[model samples]
Target: MKSPQDWPEPIVRVQSLSDSGISTIPNKYVKPPIERPSLSNSFNNDINIPTIDFLGLFTSDGNNYANKSIIYEQISEACRNWGFFQVVNHGVPPELMDEAREVWREFFHHPMDVKQTYANTPKTYEGYGSRLGVEKGAILDWSDYYFLHYLPCSLKVHNKWPAFPLSLRKVIEEYSKQVVKFCGRLMKILSSNLGLKEDVLQNAFGGDRDIGACLRVNFYPKCPQPDLTLGLSPHSDPGGMTILLPDQHVAGLQVRRDGHWITVKPASHAFIVNIGDQIQVLSNAIYKSVEHRVIVNSAEERVSLAFFYNPKSDLLIEPVKELVTKQNPPLYPPRTFDEYRLYMRTKGPQGKSQLGESDKSQDEK
Candidate 1:
C-alpha cells in the first residue's frame, strides 16, 4: 500500500468537468455494473428513514417526563432499527442553515484558481478535496468537498477556512457551534438509553472540550450519466455519528434496509442523523451503523454539509464494561479511532470492510 500522503493520480475537481459540459464522465468515475446505483432493482418509494420531532422534547425539568420518555423510546428504537433519523425543531435557526449552505455554494462557484489555492493533501485532508482514500486507480466518487477541523481548538485555524464569500467563515463557525452542542446532548441521551451514566459516551469521546469534530462540505456536481456512477459509494461512516444538513430540494441519500435501498426525503429545516462505526463498537452491537450512499443527478447539482462528531483519535473505543458479559462478551476488540480508520485513509470505502475483521468474532458464532 502507498503512503496516505501519496495520491496515486493527479487530482481533478468534479465541478470543473460538470461545468465543462462534458457528456461523458471519465472512465475513472464509472463503477462496474454491479456497483452502479441504477442496477439496484429495489427502490422503496413509500418508506423513509424515521423522522423525530425535537420540539419540547427536552424543555422543562421533569414536568415533561412522560413526553420526554416517549421520545427517548422513539430515539432508542430509531437507533436500533434503522441507525438513522431526521430531527425537526432541532434548535438551529432555519435561516442560519440556509445561509451556511448558500455561502458554500457561492464559494464553489468561484474561479478554480481561487478554490485551488487551498487544495488539500492526503496528510491532513483539511482543505479542498476531490476524493477520499489514496489507492492508485481507485474508482472515484462524483463529487468534490472542502473539509476543515472544528474542535480541540488547536486544529481550529480560522486562516485555513475559506476567506471569500465574505460570510462563509462566520456562518461556518456559528453553524458548527450549534450542531456541536446538539451532538453533545444527543450523546447524553444515548448514554442514558443504554443504562450507563449520562456522561459515559462523552467521557469516552475525550470529554466535552477535547473531543474531535470536523465538517466535510460535499458538492455533487450534476452528472450527464447519473446511472453509471454514484455521488458517493456504499459504506458505513467511520466516526461516532454524523449530522447532515441536506439540500432540501433534492433526494439523493439512500439507506440500505433489509436488502432494499430507501431514498431519504429531507424534511425542511431538519437535520439527518446516522450512526457511525465508533458508536457501534461503544454500543456493543446494540446499534449497527447501516451502509448508505449518495446519488448524483442529470438535471441539478447538489451541496450538503456532513458534520462528524468523533472520538479523540488516540483513545481506545470498545464495548462498554456494562454491556460486556460472559454470555455477551465484547463483540469487538478495543481499537483507537486512529488505528481503526487507517483502512479508509489508504484504501477508501468498501462496505464495512474496515470493521469486517473486527466483526469476524461475531460472525463465527
Candidate 2:
C-alpha cells in the first residue's frame, strides 16, 4: 500500500512489513529446490548461516597454518555441503579494495552521456547501467550496476574507460590484476582439496584457453518501500568463481542456506568468495554453486563490487576424466561456455539448471 514517493529511495514497498521489519517471504519468489527442502520440527528459532573467516592466513603461530587448513577443509565442506561461505583476510590488500570501490563510484557518477557511451551495445555484454535483468524482467528489483569483462584484454577497450578522476583507470587496472591473482590462488586451494594436483583447477580454467573475468558494480538506492522489492533476485553464479567486496557499513547481502535466507554480515577489509557452477562441474560435483540474493535497505544507498572469474567462452567444460569412476560417475556432460551462456539467457534472469551440451553427451564413454 506504500507509494514509491512515500516510503524510501531504493526500496519500493508494495506490501508492508511488521513492526520489526520481518515479514513472510512470498512463496512465489523462493528458489525451487532440487528436491523439496525439509523443515525443522522446532518452530522456535531463527536459522544461523555459517561464516568462514579468512584472517587465519596471517597468524605466525602454528595455529595460523593449522587454522588455514581447517578453514580450507571447512570451505571445501561448505562448497560440497553448503555451496557457499564468506571469507575475510583474503590476501587482496584492503587498500586496493578501498581504491576499487572509489573507482566504481567515480565511473558510475560520470555524466549519463559519458556512461552510456560504454552502455551495453547490441551484442556486447559489458559496461554501465541497469544490466540484463533490469530492463526486460517481469519483476523490478532496486539495484543499478556496471559490468566489465576484463579478460582477453583485446576484448576490452581501455579507451572506453572513463577519463575523469585522473587515477580511476590506474586504480581499476591494479584492482583487476590483484583479483586475477586471487582467482589463481583460490583455484589452487580448491584443486588441492579435491584431491588433485594444486594446479589442476587453474589449468582447467585457463588451460590452452583464455580465462573470462568481469567486474560488476551494483548500487542499491535507499528504497521508499523496503518490503516489496529485491536488490538482486535469488540465483546462482553461472561462472567459475565470484569474489565480492561489499560496502563496509551497510548490510543487505544474503544467501539461501539450509532452508532459509541468511543475512551475510559485511566485514571491513574482507572479500567474500563463492564457488560458481563451472567450478562445480570441473570439481566433478565436489563443489557447488549456491543460490544467493541481496536485500535492499531503506536507510542508505548500498554498493557492492562483484568480480566474476569465468572460463573462456570457447572452452569445453566437463568433469576431469580422472574424477569419474564406477563409484564416482560424472554428473554432467562436456559443454562449452557459449552453450551455457545461451542457456542462461533463455532461462531468463531467475532460471536455474546448468545446461550442458545435451543429454546425449551424458552417455559418452
Candidate 3:
C-alpha cells in the first residue's frame, strides 16, 4: 500500500518540443521588479484591499431575484469601482484554505537540497524558481514559488511534494476540486449580470471539458529590508480569474483602483478574487481584469496561494452578443486564449497581458 508521502516516484514524461529532447511548459510573462528611490514619506502605507461581506452581498432573507439583486450590486461595484474584493462565505470551507496552506508550507520548508530536485532551469518550465523578473538585467522581485499546472489530472506530475504530510495529496486534490466549483459559481453570477442566461459563461467553458488551472504557491521570505523587496511585481493575472488565499493576519495584497493602489486587507476566512482577461472578453470587457500587485514587509514573510482559472486553450472567446445591445456593440472580436498567450510570450515580460486596448488601437485607422 503506497502512502501519500511515500508513493513510488512516477517518472515525468513530456513530449519533446524542440531540437533538444527536453520538455517545456509555458513560462509566465516575466517583468523587471519596479524599484522605488526610497521608502518615501508620502507614499501610501495606509491603503488596503477592499473587503465584501458575502452575507451582506447575498442577503439570505430575500426572494426571487433578491439574493441575486444583492450579488449583482456588489459584483458590479467590485468589478467597476474597485476591480478586486475579498470574498467571504464564498462556500469554499475555511478548513480547506488552511489545509492547502499547510501542505504548501510543508513542501517549501523541505531542505534546499530536496526542493532543488524540482529546479525548472531553462529546459523545463515545470519545476521551481526563486524571485520574479529572471531575465538578464531585470531587477528581481523578492519572492520564492513552486509552480504547477493542474487539470486534466494526467498533466499533473508531482515534482518535490513534501514526504512527511500524511494528508498532502488528499488535501490538495480536494482543494483543487473545490476551486473548480468556485470558478463555475462565479462565472454564472457574472453571466446573469451580463444579461445572459445563468449558464452562458459556464457553457462557454464547454460541457465538462475541464477548465484550465495554474497554481503558484508563493513563499515570501523575510527580507532584511522589506522596503527594498516586493513579494510580487505589479502585474495582472493572465487567466480568466484568479483565486487568492493569503496569510491570515498579514496585510500585503493590493490592487490598482481608480488612480491609486489600495491595499487588500487579509480577512479571517475569505478568498480574495480577481477577474482576468478571458472573462473580460466574454463579458465584453465590462467586467475588467484589474491590475494588482503585492508588497513585502521587513518583519515576516508572507505565504499565498494563487489559483489561475482559465478556459480550455481551444475555446473561442468572443463578447456575448446578448450582452451587446444597440447601445453596446461587440467590443472585442473572437479570439482564443491560446493565441493571446502566444502573443504575450513573444512580447516578453512587460506584464501587460490584456489585449483589449491593443486590439482597439489596431482597429483605429
Question: Number of the top candidate by TM-score?
Answer: 1
The TM-score values for the models, in the order shown, are 0.96, 0.79, 0.78
Distance from true location, Cα of 198 in model 1, Å: 0.7
What candidate 2 gets wrong by more than 4 Å, as runs, is 1-67, 133-137, 355-365
How would you order the candidates by lDDT, starting with the best?
A: 1, 2, 3
Q: Compose the digit string of candidate 3's lDDT tens values, residues 63-96.
A: 6366667667788777755557788887788888
* Sliding window of 10 residues with minimal summed lDDT for model 1: 356-365
Query: Which tens-of-lDDT digit does each residue in 199-238 have in candidate 1?
Result: 9999999999889999999999999999999998888898
What clash count goes with each model?
0, 12, 6
Give the runs in model 3 whose Cα sits over 4 Å from its true position.
1-50, 55-65, 121-124, 131-134, 158-164, 325-327, 342-353, 356-365
Report clash pairs, candidate 3: 30-349, 48-263, 48-264, 49-263, 49-264, 49-265
Stronger candidate by TM-score (1 vs 3): 1
